[model samples]
Target: MLKSLITAIRTLTLFSVPGRDTESFSNTLFWFPVVGLFLGLLQALFGYGAHLSGWNELAAALVVLGGVVLTRGMHLDGLADLCDGFWGGRTKESILRIMKDPNVGSFGAIALSMHLLLKWIAVLKLVELGAFTFIAAGVLLARLTQVVLASALPYARREGGTAQAFVTGAGWMHISVASLFTLLFLFPLLHQDLHALLALLAASIAAGGMTGLLSYKKIEGVTGDVLGAASELTEVFVWISGALYLLLSGNG
Candidate 1:
């Protein structure tokens, strides 16, 4: 179990969990959400400490940023590539062509900017609301969407790419492991606010639904870009949903 957990995180994130590097385990499909949970755990520990220490919003934000930086900006790169491809290309073939290119286009730049700005603002708001747990929960929800995409969709292209392994078939057990780990990581916060917890789960489902539909229509399947987009989109939705929950419930 310990080794498999590390394998899941190793395959999913930029982190290289050290151990035996046999091809069979190394090539195993990465569980996206499980990686997110590991990342979230780091963010939660650091962010909570920052929040408790009376750190400003910017400092807290930097803690979250640091977690991504340590992961080598893997998801962010995917988000940029996805934006470059999905918006720049006029047709299906063109989109795939643009995605295949290594260069980052104008559409990608704009999309990335918007995504970062929104994320920054949302994180700041969460800090203001004292919703540290929600921040962690948001990370979990976003990553779970990645697992759903990996399990449900086909590879968008004929040739191999980043999202190929999981989409091809990572199996139900892999999915369950990812999902269960996410829940365990998140369970600590559930004792604080049940409604917020449920809201995060709901937001996750919605994010998954949105991603699933978009992938079906736009690419006819999932790709690295699709998975990345799902991560970012789900993150955003979780933040929004959690914020709204706090507002409506008079908890904030």
Candidate 2:
């Protein structure tokens, strides 16, 4: 179990831990939310401290950077690939080919720009509201969405790939365990504000579900890029929705 946890950590982030990974990620998937919760806690703590110190704006950008640094920008690269391939390609073959390309096209550049801008704005608003604890919610749900996604879709790469082991081996048992890990951290967000948390969970479900639907239609299944895109989208959706909710409720 400890080695499996290390696999989850090493696979998900740039964090260096001493241990060999299990041959397969079926069990490693169980630790995904655990890694996410760890990332969320660090981000939330830094954001909270920055808020108290009156550097919330800089902290917001750094919070965004913290995620990228930890994950090594893999998810952002996936988002860019998804945008470039899905919009620029005329067929499935072309889509897959384009996604495999290392170059980011016009579509990808625009997507990265808009996505980063929106994420920064949403995060900035959240911190400005003094609700820094909720920062963990978005990060936690992002990783959980990936776990759900891996379980929901067949691996798209026919020749096998880095994510095939994780995606193909996933099941409900994995999701259930990951979900428990996710919720264990939520109680500290608002003490008794589960309604908002549940609503955010629903929002994440919708975001992840939409990614699955689009990936299914695009290439008839999922790739590593698809899973990464799902994580990126779900995190931003939760943050955007939470920011809006707080603003509308006069809590901001």
Candidate 3:
């Protein structure tokens, strides 16, 4: 269990150790939310500190930048690749080929910019509302969405790829475990406000589902890029939902 926890941390974060066994890294999918919890704590700390310092704009920017840096910008890369492939390609083959290319195109640049802008705006609003808790919850839900996608979708690559291991190794057990972690973290954070919690969950699941459906339609299954895109979209959707809730409640 300790090894699995370590493997989970190593897999999801920038942290690494020499001679670490990766044989069970896929099994660590059940612990993805655990990593999310750690990420959320960091985001909350950073945002809270900036809020205390009366730099809400800087806080929002830093929180978004912190997420990118902490995850090594892998999800952002996936979002860019997904946009470049989905819009730039005319067919499945072209889409897959385009996504594999290391270069970012016009579509990718636009998509990445729009996503970051929306995220920054949402974070800024949440900061104004003193709603740092939702940032952590958003992070947790983002990873939980990944677990859901891995368990539900088959791997897209016929020749196998980085995502194949997790798709093949993870199952309902993994999903259940990850969901348990999500509920454990999320419920306490939002138990005082059920409406906000439900809205965030609904938005997150919807975003993840739409992402998976699009991937299935395009590639007949999910890929590493799809998973990454799903995570980023889920995060954005959660933040948007929470932000909207704050606005409607006159808290923003």
Candidate 4:
């Protein structure tokens, strides 16, 4: 279990591992939320420190940068690929080919820029509102979406790629375990506020479902890039939802 946890962390972040353990890596799906909690803790600490230092804006920017750095920009790259493929490719073959390419096109560049900008703005708003809890929760929810995508969707590629092992190995049982972990983390944060909890749940489901549907329509299945895109889109959705909730409730 410890090895699986380590594999989850190493695979999801820029963290180094002593050695590659394929078996452990295969079991890492169940621990995805744990890795997310670790990330959330880091961001929460940074946000709290920023609050104390009277540099919330700077801290928020750093938190956003930290996410990119920690994840090695893999999610962002996936988002770019998805954008390029979905819009640029008219056929499944073309879409797969486009997504597999390492080069970023104009559409991809625009999408990445917009995504980063929106994320920065959302984080800035969260910091200003002192909603560190939401930041942490957003990370957890975003990662949970990835686990769902892996377990629920068939891999689009026939020639198995980087994410194939995970998708193939993760079953409904794994999804159940990951969902349990997510609820364990989320319940306490939201138990006192049913409205907030419901809103967050709705937002997460909507984001994940929408992304999955789009991926399915475009390619008939999900890819590693789709999972990456889903993670990023879900994070942004959570942040946006939380920020809007705060604003509407007169807290912002």
Best by lDDT: 3
Q: After superposing candidate 3, which stretches have Cα over 4 Å from the reference?
A: 17-19, 250-252
Global lDDT of model 3:
0.88
Per-residue CA lDDT of model 3 for 60-104, tens digit only, reads 988898899888999999999999999999888899999999999
Q: Pairing residues by index, what is the TM-score of model 4? A: 0.94
Report residue 120 deviation for candidate 3 (angstroms).
Answer: 0.2
**Candidate 1 on 101-152: residue-level lDDT in tens?**
8888898788778877777777767777877777777877777777777777
Question: Model 2 TM-score?
Answer: 0.96
Please give the distance, in angstroms, between residue 98's alpha carbon in candidate 3 and its true position after superposition: 0.8
TM-scores for every predicted model = 0.86, 0.96, 0.96, 0.94
Looking at model 4, residue 190 earns an lDDT score of: 55
Q: Which pairs in model 4 have colliding backbones?
A: none
Candidate 2 lDDT over residue span 68-125, tens digit each = 8889999999999999999999888899889999999999999999998988888899
Candidate with better TM-score, 2 vs 4: 2
Which 10-residue span in candidate 3 carries the lowest summed lDDT? 17-26
* Superposed Cα deviation of residue 187, candidate 3 (Å): 1.1
Residue-level error in angstroms, candidate 4, position 192: 3.1
Clashes of each: 0, 0, 0, 0
